[model samples]
Target: MKVRVGFGYDVHALVPERDLWLGGVKIEHTMGLQGHSDADVLIHAICDALLGAANMRDIGYHFPDTAGEYKDIDSKILLFDTMELLRDAGYTLGNIDATVAAERPKLNPHIPEMKRVMADVLQVDVEDISIKATTTEKLGFTGRQEGIAAYATVLIQK
Candidate 1:
């Protein structure tokens, strides 16, 4: 079997009136990430990682913000579509390790739900996907609560 790995990262600014979504789970927060879609940075990172692993390009290539169909669209759909593209290309998911960076609302407590939701969306065992969250120690935009960022690494095999 041929095995490959891919890494992805995404970030978005925080803005008022937007809902916070990470790993497919909506969390209570005073500010939400701003983007053309639902602004789920974690999900976007995962999508990019999966696409990169398969050499299929990134999420923006497949789903451009300029397209009206993707405006305010749910990011989970993008993730699901990305997985389908990989499957069609004869690749199967091996595992994924992902981390989200944010300063407020404390993410560790929501990791479980995030894993469950993402696993369901990816149709993979929850064990195959590991989600973690951290603070930047007030060193970056994330720590300052100006924005949120996420990183994802994935292993895939054919």
Candidate 2:
């Protein structure tokens, strides 16, 4: 078996009047992430990791923000498409570990749902995907509640 590893990171500014989405699940919060899509930072990071593992480029390459079709699109669709792209490249997921950084709204309570949602979207065992949350200790954009950021690492094999 051939195994490959990839890493991804993403950030989005928080703004009013938008729904906060992470790992394909929406969380109730005073502010939401701003982006062309639903701005699920976790899912976007995972997609980039998968694409990088397959050496097929990144999510922006496959789904450009400049395209009107992606405007306000659901990120779960993007995750599904990313999985298809990996499968087409003859790569299957081994595992994924992802972390989200935020200062408010308490992410820990929502992690389980996020894992379930992402697993369903990727058609993978929930055990294969691990989602974690953390605070930046009142530093940087995430710490200051200006934005949310996520990092993901993935293992893929053929």
Candidate 3:
């Protein structure tokens, strides 16, 4: 079997009147992430990592913000499509480990659901997906609640 690993990072500014989406789960928050889509930072990072591992390019290459089709679209669809791309390349998921950074809304409580949702989307076992959360210790944009950031590392095999 051939195995490859990839890493990804993403961030988005916080804005009012939007919904906060992370790892395919919606979390209640005073401010949501700003983006052309639902702005799920965690999902975007995972998508990038998976695509990179397969050497298929990043998420923007497949889903462009300039395109109207992605506007206000559900990020879960993006994640699902990403998995299809990986499968088409003759690769299957091995595992994914990801982290999210934010100052508020307490992510730990929601991790289990996030993992469940991602696993369902990727058609992988729940054990294959791990989601972690952290704060920037009041040191950066995430710490100040100005935005949210996420990092993901993934292993894929063929």
In model 1, the worst 10-residue window by lDDT is 135-144
Looking at model 3, report the run of 10 residues with the lowest lDDT sum.
136-145
Give the alpha carbon lDDT tens digit for every residue of 20-42 in model 3.
99999999989899999999999
Return the clash pairs for model 2, or none: none
How many pairs in model 3 have backbone atoms within 3 A of each other, for residues 3 or more apart or on separate chains, i.e. clashes? 0
Q: 1-61 in candidate 2: lDDT tens per residue?
A: 9999999999999999999998888899999999999999999999999999989899999
Cα lDDT for residue 48, model 3?
Answer: 97
**Which residue segments of model 2 deviate by more than 4 Å?**
none
For all candidates, the clash counts are: 0, 0, 0
Scored by CA lDDT, what does every candidate get?
0.94, 0.94, 0.95
Better of 1 and 3 by lDDT: 3
lDDT top scorer: 3
lDDT of 2 at 75: 97
Under the 3 Å rule for N, CA and C atoms, how many clashes does model 1 have? 0
Q: Given candidate 3, what's the lDDT at residue 46?
A: 97
- Pairs that collide in candidate 3 are none
In candidate 1, which residue ranges exceed 4 Å CA deviation? Answer: none
